[model samples]
Target: MLLFGTAGIPASTKTNGDTVAGLKRIAELGLGGMEIEFVRGVYLKDNMVPPVAYVGKKLGLKLSCHAPYYLNLNHADEVRRRQAGGVLHHAAGTAARAGARTIVFHAGYYLKGSPETVYDAIKAEMEVVLGKLLDEGTEITLRPELAGKISQFGNLAEILKLSRELPGVAPAIDFAHLHASTGRYNSYPEFAEVLNRVGEALGRESLDDLHLHVSGIEYAKTGERRHLNLAESDFRYDELLQALADVKAGGLLICESPNIEEDTLLLQRTYLDLSPRT
Candidate 1:
């Protein structure tokens, strides 16, 4: 049931003026969903929301969102930490209005603090964000992505814990980040092991509607350098997709590579070709 798609508006779109057009282009391209790239801000007007949601529904497109990238929940200053909550609130609102069920974000960095302390700070901030989203009646899953850098707060264990404890939360698994972060999991067995851990920690139901980011990437020991086109990089995507199929993981797998549509299509075809017969 995995839906392969682009991270933003498809590069092949005839018109890229609006997200509705983008969704239409995604549907036209035979893709399944698109992530609304609110990497800078999440400010969908009251008038603009319905049309975006409407077009997605009409076209049978699954929608998800990427919240602003710079939000740091573990900011030392209370003002900035609180500001992150406000931004997440708005992101949930935007996702709700756009018929998206998940809002993925890079939670924060671990600056000069124990990993446990950083985790507490992020958890506290996320509780506030989630509580507000709940009270406001905007139902959306808040996913803290596994970050690529060594300095980042989210690791696989941390994100899994957050998803386990927080209501309406989950990990947005980016295989590129995993490979970049650890310099591991580039093999079939390792990929399967990651899925096994996910299933063990979050249960099989967590595999049902995964939010994933897949790409070929370059990384150093410190972690992620940049994304590369699938064929250009040595990322074991074919093996990863095969692992996903074996685990029966189904959901949106958005391509974040520089060439979004081409890589997305490549991923979809590879997964399908590797899949077992019903």
Candidate 2:
């Protein structure tokens, strides 16, 4: 079940149009899923849930949420670190209300700390958040994304290790971020190794039900700057799609391209063309 979708509402829709309506419109466009961009803040008020959930259920759309990017669980101040947990808690709760199965977030920044120290700090903070979610009976999985920049805490191995150490958590493998972060290793063998490593550390189910973010991204000596449309960027998406098909990865691939729907459809078409027929 290869799921292809856009990061947010399609560009053709009016800005700040009704979210539920926008989702319905995108579903009609034949996209398999939609990711609510809570990158700034979690904006779904309590009153909005019923309508949003109603439309999402009616349209059979798979929903996920990207939590705010302002998180830094490894902050030097304990107060600020606790605030980050609160933000994640709010985002997780809001995502559950919106019928989202996964709540994605950037785990933290390195901030002059050793990777081991930062990982331990992040793990401790996530344990608190996970406990809170369990107490509140929220079923949405918390996903720490692969950060593009080397300075950030999240790397492929770090996120994978965190998921292994924590319950009810997983890695959101942003392929573009992996490409940029590693300075370009997007071949079929490299991609296969990535899936293999995640499966080896986490489990086969993690790969099957993966949550992914994909786009052609711009980067430099450090890492990701911004996302570009597939046509404008140098990402080897065709080979990537083939690798995914070979693995039978069964989850959402949300496109974060500037031209969201167009690139998403391009991905969908490419995957379908590359996948072997039964």
Q: Each candidate's root-mean-square deviation in Å?
A: 1.3, 1.4
Each prediction's Cα lDDT score? 0.90, 0.89
Candidate 2 structure quality by residue, lDDT tens digits, 122-223:
999999999999998999999999999988889988899889988899999999999998887778889888888988998889878899899999999899
State in Å the error of residue 208, model 2. 1.6
Runs off by more than 4 Å, candidate 2:
none
Off by over 4 Å in 1: none
Candidate 1 lands at a TM-score of: 0.97
lDDT of 1 at 239: 87
Per-residue lDDT of candidate 1, residues 7-98 (tens digit): 98888777755788889889878999999999988767778899999999999989999999889999989999999888888887888899
